[model samples]
Target chain A: MTDALLRIEGVSKRFGGVIASDNISLEIRPGELHAVIGPNGAGKTTLIGQLMGEIGPDSGKVVFEGNDITVLPTWQRGQLGLARSFQITSLFLNFTALDNVALAVQARSGHSFHFWRDARRLPELRVPARDALARVGLAGREDVVVSNMSHGEHRQIEIAMALAMQPRMLLLDEPMAGMGPEESARLVETLRELKQELTILLIEHDMEAVFALADRISVLVYGRVIASGAPEHIRSNAEVRRAYLGDGKKKAAGGHG
Target chain B: MKTIFTVRNVLVFGLLAFLAVIPAYADVTGNTFIMTLFTRIVILAIAAVSLNLIMSYGGMVSFGHAAYLGIGGYAVGILAFEGINSGFVQWPVAMIACGLFALVTGALSLRTRGVYFIMITLAFAQMIYYVGVSLDRYGADDGLTIYKRSNFGSLINLSNKTTFYYVCLVTLFATMYLVWRLVNSRFGMVIQGARSNDRRMRAIGIPTFRYRLVCFVIAGMMCGLAGILLANQADFVSPATMHWTRSGDLIVMAVLGGMGSVIGPVVGAVALLVLEETLPHIIAVVGHFVTGLEMTAAREYWQLVLGPMLLLVVLYARGGIDGLLRGGRRD
Candidate 1:
């Protein structure tokens, strides 16, 4: 729809004989959390890559705020307020948590051609970076080097980096991929608060978090979106249950309450 | 700032003071050869520092860095041969030439990664080396000699060995200061981020390639300045100046010194060159004492000792000498 903040229209991608994305069309509305649920090898990550401009779609248009940005470079897309967190936890391991988030803030400030001023000493970058870290419950851990931090804490830093950019929408690929239950719960709580202000497209295997936080759920199977609608509609959709959510029904039900 | 009195700072200050007084010490001892050797060390240290900018921070391992040294040297040599000897004109020409070479080669070479990048850079340097060989008018492989040093009007005397040594020392410190400022700046953040993860850097709204190319050009220009000093120091230029082995030596200097910090490469250049100067005599004495071998024969096998030492440093001291001094602390 024209009101949709991000719209993917019939995007398809092929890798040799494998179809990574097969006519995948979806929409993310403003201030809404959209969760895409899929089985392993369902090309969920490929979808995120296409939207983030890392992978080219064979046939389709990606419209953001009614602008066709299908072929824009990844950084230009990011400049247009589209941000992403890696599924495999990519971070500047040598840098401190505050330094990592400040880099994200620096990316959005302008062209970083500054060659003399110490970037780490800037209050403008540090203040927002601190606020984002505190929002993710990592207030006191800012000075910890990322390589030394726990895996769950790295995920939180990932989110803090995305938030520091003040992005219009976030494409998060498995933000809770390696997190424990306690960390998952903490992240779910953070997302609940964030959903009030930001648009998010979440690709997660955790059904409980998906059912609890998603305003609308889309079920993808083998690069195809089988169903997309309200959470209740997706839960009852027979095809979605048969293709992807069969074993997750109990967890989804528990989360809904 | 309170950590300024740390062991590393003290050692660094001690080294700087030692360098500053080398000419005075030579004057007292009448051992002018020491001044000449130290001047070469200081000039090459600037090149090593430039290499560290791309290798350590930008994660670009160029194997053809010596090509810039040759380019800068040849810029002076060729101009001096043509009867143009002004430092102002010759120096800028050398820097611009090196920058242009870097831009063209970097555009093609950066398209590949890992060993491919290394090989491409090596190939380009070899190509330049061959071009140097083909310049028969400039003495080709026999090399070209500059009859006079670059003329700076009333500025300073390059003919004075002591004055030239001071100039090289000043330039090394300035290069280190510039690199320190660059790596801490906003531009440096983007460069380091790209080095850590190029994909993530692009996703985070940094047009990484352009920034990296610019970095490559800056490093080339800096190394070119070192080349100018080296040509002036020796008053000669040859194709061998940018030989692949020379490139390898620059890489060794960076690795040996500690690429993580600005001063590490300077330490590395001094250490490697000084070891090269003294290791043969040390080997001869040790060999004569241990196994009763003839001193000259033992000196011939000096590399046998140096090889294992380098291996030990690579294996045990992964961060090089600078890392060893820091005791595993991050720079």
Candidate 2:
């Protein structure tokens, strides 16, 4: 726990009598790819929302880099080296891929009160924007408007925008939410590479990617962590199988090469 | 991206050329009424440009925008009424009053979104309008006549028609230039991003409310400056200046011109005002020609034509005049 890069300690939330997060606790080690998997309404998105400061927990602490950031605003959390992408593809649809990434790049640089020079012309902002896009395999599509891009491409651009923030860690909420298998496979590869460089707390349902990429996996059901362990142990856990994996454990084990 | 020879660019340059030579054209044709009409359009165009900053670019549809214009014009009028007739003092007062109004309204109103925001702004504008009507010393609903224009003294004279017209025209151009610079800057990007997806903006670590508030205040100040110019242009100030309908007119101009482009609202202002000025004459001429009778009443129905033209623009020309010229390509 002392060495954990991010920790959620007994966080609980209720929405009009519905228990969304019930005494949830977890720790993500630095440089480890931690996956939180759950069925629909398992409060996976709620967990990510709490981490990103978009949702206020009814109780408990969210400690990032050993700082209690439970009440911090979302942007302040970003300033604290935490970043997140949306589950439903939230992006500046009117802006180009580069423009979207560049804005994320600008947000972390300094005060954006600059009202004179053409922002697109600034190399200082655009250079890092390009690098982030390139890192996410979106280099050639930088100038394309986000609305014109494919769903997969939008997913990639979302990751690029998060990367542009240059945060110490990323809270990715279903980066593979709507992707096709091909796009999902590409994203898995991208995530595989990114896990080596930056600490990632991923909430996803893509079983193959989760087993292949997650150094540690937590199973959540009805807003509570039922089990947490490494992929191999989680795969064999009798409780996890009964609760989540069901018949899919055999496929997840044999399905991936 | 706006390549020099695009149809939109040509039309913009043509409009600029026409505006620049209106005084000269009026001189050659011995038709000074055109100058008077265009000067009004030019000044109102400044107001429309300010609205566009938050409307088209920032995605903040302020239905109460006319309140600033009223505040600005009243600042000039009240100051002049008190014998403080200096242009320097009156203009700054107008801007400050408008800025303060925007700060308060924006702080409260920006907390809500969509129709609620629109309704709150409208409510504020109406409150100011009735306040204007209730000011018995300022002539209330009957309005007030400015006995003296803003005195610039040695710098320039506002009473000279040609000079005032040029002044309005120059100010319009400067406002356009400023908006052009602002919409392309880093600050502009945040405003646009917020408009596109505000949640995404906050999730990416931007305190969107502050940026939105600043834009609202800047827009208010700009409209306030236009109000000062408008008061000087008319030598009058009235409560009707801030009426909700006037705010609607600004919105119409923004949508009619193209909300996404900087010059779209200016184009809309020119088109709507010019049509308002000339349609009566056109209707009178056409009615007499076609009916072979004195059909003088048709001129009164000019807005009948305007309603449909706006409808057509809204339906088919979603980008407004600028977007139409750009063949409906939007950023």
Candidate 3:
């Protein structure tokens, strides 16, 4: 059997009597594009937060690379090869795109306590940042300030920042949430290219993109995983049809949904 | 044309050149007091720069910075009063006191943010001020006087006015350079990221609180060094040195200079101190011409005009003197 990159077993979370994740168990293998989908407030974001060590599961364990990391802090998990992007675009709007990515590269390198040389002037920090930006199709835009970028481009930079960390598996939350059809199509193509090289655990609402890109799909509702399978199996599963796609027209959308 | 004169770059190089040359000209003219005055400017600028590190970059506004200054000054003064005049003994005690205070205060204050954080820091500084007032041997509320400067021997004679001025200048430049490097370092990036969006930084696997707290302590320790030099410069230490209002003055300096860049606070310190020195003179001269008013009376009410001037700076010159001189170039 292939080594599982991420294994979540019986993980549950509660906030003041509200269940965010209810004993959700799932495994993501290396180099696979796994997608998580749910209706609004289905605990998708909370589950991603628990995976990145932003929130601890009330019960159950999160094992990554065969090591239990349920208690690790965020940065430690980051160092151990887990990287995530925000559902909301969060960036240093005051800084140039190059500066933002350069900072992430700096984090993975040695100690940043060196006080004399200007990091901007250092070629080591800039080279990898340049490479990361190029990978995200933002090569010439590195000098542009983040505030000046369009909403779609800002989203792209967010992913570029995560890519700069060079993680084993990428957790992307709502990567195409706010975009025009053209922008969404472009991001879909980019993810299609990236999936060949890196394992990705994506949470998105665009059913077309989710079905087009996800190697496997997991359906979440009211904080529990209701079904998990390949696109064909999930599409044919009867309960998934009733619980998630029971809205008659969406059910007609068939495997596309 | 705008590309050639970005507000951030123009102000940075321009200020460095001016600081380097001011003392050189003053020295040639034998107006040595200008050197002393500038030295005072440089030392406090160091503290202002430290405040900017946490405030502008880390997104933490602390009103208790002057407490570290007073703690550092008292460390030197109390040690001196007890016949321990060595720089070695005095400097480390000042740093340790500031660090200890910062660690405790940061632990409590970091739990709160925004206006609550501001008020809590102010309250802690006030507590320190009161403790300074109760030190009877160090002159209590009246203050402690240092009979001699720190003994660094042949390494640098701080007793000589020019030498001391150079020392302050070097330290100020060093601190500015250090802060510039810090804001661009990996740790600094995490701090800035936290400042920009703490929720996002945490989502992306960056633990933010520990970085912020460390930034807080580093800022406090830096201000402590400023306090040591301040006591040495004035040859005195007192409760008044650490008053919460004094912390207000440091904040004003950082804001007035422009908090976006490392060198802005230094420019603010020079502008403020120079104005403090020359405003009374201008007021006295104008008063003498207008109403034949006595110089002493004109001097006493100098603050009347000073308050309005600062208000104007805050109103019209939102970027402060650096911004004004650079023609409103904002980063």
Candidate 4:
């Protein structure tokens, strides 16, 4: 058995004639923050979709925690300790913020077939839901309904929901997609703290956050990983510079790490 | 048990109080017709409450909800035809038959969504409606009349109009309480969350399909009970009870009452049925004065007012009557 917590071996996917994931393969070792960075249309989201079982790879095996999850449904993957945060904030808009997180907590805690007790009145669920919200700096805002929350707050709730599931690994797709600068910084800090306790597959366009938090960075260009190594190696990789940084641009090398 | 002490809560309590005292007022006024009309309203309100469970809360708009009414009614009618008149035997059979139908239809229909879901459910309900029309021994499309109501023995008297009305009212409130408890429960939350965002629910490990199917079946069974009561109240069963227009009426009631709230559809039933009873008369009186037209002609044109009024409500009252009562606030 391999030591990798998640192994993507020779995965390829195509949307008709468009080669979205071209025989790409990567491994995420246990308890390490692995960031996949690419420009627009580098198949970043497609890769996440395949891993989460929303899109099937034409020819590849996705092994997670010693199970081949290539054909498993999205809910099964979630039950196997795999969680995803949508690039666009998706939450129960009509429910309270606490109710949203409580549902996620409810997923992992037990079967949701209990139809008698009020979930809102249950301390077992609401308490950890509150804890999850607090972890994402949404402490006092638990009672605020998501419909009234800001876009940035929705992003935070997305992460909080994943956290509430208590998954062994997280497949975060652009967690900072629409966050303001202040919100982005706060999320980066949250992710940094989160990485201390979990394995993370981060897909982001925020170069500064990538350089700051990623243990190892992989540069994807045109549905292929051209370089995968430490932050310093990727910062100086010749091909990555040409394809991503456009070579002669000043501050071309990302040195935040 | 935590009361919001809002205006909405006050109105809901006030409405309940009015319903509670209706029997006493009807007895004093010797208005048995009013009692009969309100009894029909309470029975329909139960069915609407069941629809609200999945329709509004679960985001499943089944356009053939009246199928359960027919199925339950047929179960009672068919059983009575076969010499089974016990409420115990008839009621459970009705529930199981409706539940089984819901299970099968829901399994297939849940595979589709949006307008397709609406169409598939409508198709299933119509299929049942025609089936009801073809039951030759049960009087087919002409309907069947019962010689006696289900024998409940000494515990309850179904023959007494006031007793039957009270029974319907009590059962209606019980259903409301059950639904209120349910929506606050874990199962209800799962259904509501799936309604809001099914994809996210799966991302967090909720197998939403099974829950949705169970919810569909539960709603069907509840409405099935309403159907049993409806057959007893009418002392008859017919294919007309399950017609497409009746299904549309239920939708209008749920939407008008306020789908998000449990009691909203009940209010909707009261409003729609009450309007149906009184509007034709009101139009006849007003039109005779204004247009100097014959009473029947004026009454026949009442829908012109109703059509515009429903359109206005749909456009302006996004949350329906319950929402309007709460000043457009959603629960």
Candidate 5:
């Protein structure tokens, strides 16, 4: 019970001459919504990419469920119950909203080689897919093609996909980007509900949502974490203000909260 | 409800009916040319359908699909030369050879993307084509002739044109049905998602490459079956069966029909071959009537018309003939 669901121990990633994730260490306990926020180029996405097994860290290791998963490929990491949503609204556009989530549910289910019957009619797949869509407020839009949906809706579908996996840990990158206030509010509610069930590491630029949802906040700057503390402490910290909050132009240029 | 005909459903039903009726028509007409032409179309359609599994659904544009055709054809050719003419033996050998080739090629080619993937697959197929050309014992560049069609041991007399046509038709329908099941399955969903956005799939814990490789193998195996049928139809096999240009022809059949829909390739096969058969006659008539031009010269220039037709399809009819038939609808 005490073991962290995901632990990044001195994990660092370098892209060419640039350091994307500087020897950073973080631990996420169960049922915690830890938000990693930073200006642009902060390596928050890269760090998540490393943890999700999409990108390998140049040095150090990532341990998930007491297993060193630094060398594991992205799909293998998924099999171990680590799920992530993209910063970009990446989804299967041709699929109906339900079908997109159904695939995630399929990944977690038994082998997908069951070729004879239609997967869409199967209760095992469709039931979980419908539940996931309902969780993300897309119950009515399950039949809608994802490409025809709005950007905000696509983001929700992405979240629904991650949720459908029934993952032990969730890594979400900028889940609220490109959303209107109403959509953001809805997503916040969905995240709040999800936080109670799954361990979440959220990277978001929406300050209000970040402060509202994250139990702990880690501020990343130029591929390094300059500050990590309680959200209240981060909100009032002078160094954070000087380096990030105080510079409106810099923050705007660097991107979101 | 008007039953809301989708391009997919229409193509599927249309192909099935056409395949079902072809043998009966051949039985009545006694024109074996129609059966032979349809057999060629159906065999190629199998290749196109198999390719659709990866190219359209998986978003992998492999220019080397013809390589499987070569492998399958050569398998039958070499085996028949060695005094083995069993359809059962030749078909499995063809399938295994293509599957193995596809596995190795897919593994290497999957490491790349976009045009690079296309080029790598083409290169691998070309390698096989040249290898076939070098096998002097099996006729090499000259080609090998099989004296007899595959021996099915009295259950089906493939020597009978109608029987062979039905066999090709049945195989085509089976291949189409299998692909349809595959695309709608959970595995199919992953492959399609991987095609649409691979980065997103990987982010969601789906390892897309391995799934794609498996898909590549399945497609190759299907194409290999088409190759065996093709050898039976022609009673010969050669490097020309697997030439890179022939691969391009398969792509044309796929694109000309529509890439995504299961039966689009069949429609393309039927349309392309029908045009090839009739266009020369029509052109010769026009040439002789309009300007007193020789029929022989016009026949040799049929490709000029086909070249422009493909260009038009690429430019204006991006969805292919199926799109036109469905009135601008897409699958």
Candidate 6:
């Protein structure tokens, strides 16, 4: 547990009548892609939010690198090496892709109070931004404004932003949400390459990517983790099958069998 | 790098050149009124530039920016009334006072978004306005007359009208240059990022509130400089200087010019002020020709013509006049 990069212990959050995160507890070890797979409204995003310090838990703690970060603000969590990408493409729509990644680099570099120097011309920031963009296979599209880019590119930019921070762990909320098959495959490969170096808590609906890339998988259902184990273990678990994957497979079989 | 030969750049530079030569033009034509009008335009352009920093780049729509103008003016007026007429003392005091007020109000106001943010800023400005109204010792509601302009000693002569106009014109250019550096700098990038998406800014590890608050204070102090110039120009300070409507005019100037660029607000200030001054006479002439209405009566409704013009600019030119000059590019 002490070796875990992030620990969510007994985290519970309620929105009036409905519970968003009910007694959710999970751990992400160093250098592992731990994916949280769930159906819509299954508290997966809420769990990610709690880990990223955006939402407060009703009762529990989010321990990051052995520090209790339950009361820390979102930016502090980021400073402590926890970065997140939103489920919805949250970006500076007017700025270029290079500018977006460069901002992430700027956040990690130091205070941004340097008022006179042109930030775009800073090689210290631009170099890393370029490297991150290249890592995401977006080499030549650096100057494209975010709003002008496709939805899939926005998703890639989100990942590139997280990668640019060089965080200890990444909390990705549906990175492949609206991606085409080719884009998703590319992302899966990127995540595979990434998991070899960095810790990732991936909240994704793409079952193929989740099953293929996750070293460990947790099945969240109605605000609770019904199963937590290796991907093969989660795939064969009867409760998880009945709750999520099995139900989907049954519907597919009925429609096409 | 983008070419500097674009239409917007040409217009901006041309306007600067025109401002620089206005005093000579007035001297040649024996038209002192032209100099005075241009001076006011230059001073208000500084205020508009400051407003654009927060409104356009930082995404903070403050409805009480004129409060700083009032504060800055009062700092000068009150100091002069108390017999401290030194420019060195008055200007810094005005800037500091404006910064403090912005810090306090911005701390509270920035917590709210959209309409609430607008209302809180308006409320704070109104509070300052009433305070200005209640300063019974310094001419209260009617306002205080500055008997003498802040003495700059051997640095410059404030008594010379042409000298003062040049002084204001220089300040306007300096302020624009300062804002230009700010928006393109690291600090500016953070502020712009916050404006584009504040939540994403925090998610990426930049504590955005503090950056925004700093930006707000910077804007306040810059506008305060304009206030100092305004008071010196009019030789008067009143509660009306910080009135909410003045704040609205600043917003209009920024929006009308083009909030996207640093010089956009200056253009807006020039366009708005010039239209305000000329619209009545133009309206009177047009009305006389078309409707046979009395020139005086027609002139009273110049705002009717101005309102539709502003609406057209807002609807058709999303970036304002500067945006149009940039060939309709959004940013």
Interface RMSD of 3: 2.5
In model 3, what lDDT does residue A42 have?
A: 79
Q: What's the CA RMSD for each of the models?
A: 2.5, 2.6, 3.7, 2.7, 2.3, 2.5
lDDT of 6 by residue, B1-331 (tens): 9898987788789998998999999999999999999999999999999999999999899999999999999999999999999999999999999999999999999999999999999999999999999999999999999999989999998878999998998899899999999999999999999988999999999999999999999999999999999999999999999999999999999999998898899899999999999999998888788888778777888899989999999999999999999888865
* DockQ, ranked from best to worst: 6, 4, 1, 2, 5, 3
Cα TM-score of candidate 2: 0.97
- In candidate 4, what are the lDDT values of residues B154-237, reduced to their tens digit? 988888988998899999999999999888899999999999999999999999999999999999999998898899899899
Give the true-contact fraction for every prediction, in order: 0.84, 0.85, 0.49, 0.88, 0.72, 0.89
Number of clashes in every candidate structure?
0, 0, 0, 0, 2, 0
Candidate 1 on B1-331: residue-level lDDT in tens?
A: 4577878888988999999999999999999889989999999999999999999999999999999999999999999999999999999999999999999999999888889999999999999999999999999998999999999988999999999999999999999999999999999999999999898888889899999999999999999999999999999999999999999999999999888899989989999999998899998888788888678766777778777887888888888888898886765
| Candidate 4 structure lDDT | 0.90
lDDT of 6 at B179: 93
Put down candidate 3 lDDT per residue, B1-331, tens digits, no spaces.
Answer: 3566666567677777776776787878988787778778888999999999999898889998899889999999999999998887888888988998999999899888899999999999999999999988789999999998888767778788777777877888888888888887667877888888776565455667877888899899999999999999999999989998889989989888877778889888877778889888888898888887677667777778878888998899877877776667556
Which of the predicted structures, 3 or 6, would earn the higher lDDT when compared with the native? 6
Q: After superposing candidate 1, which stretches have Cα over 4 Å from the reference?
A: A248-257, B291-293
* Candidate 6 structure quality by residue, lDDT tens digits, A157-187: 9999999999989888888877888999999
Off by over 4 Å in 5: A252-257, B2-19, B23-30, B288-296
Interface RMSD of 5: 1.4
Q: How high is the CA lDDT of each candidate model?
A: 0.92, 0.90, 0.85, 0.90, 0.85, 0.92
Worst 10 residues of 6 chain B by lDDT: B291-300
* Candidates 2 and 4, the one with greater TM-score: 2
- Quick one: best DockQ, which candidate? 6
Candidate 1, residue A109: how far the Cα is off, in Å: 0.7
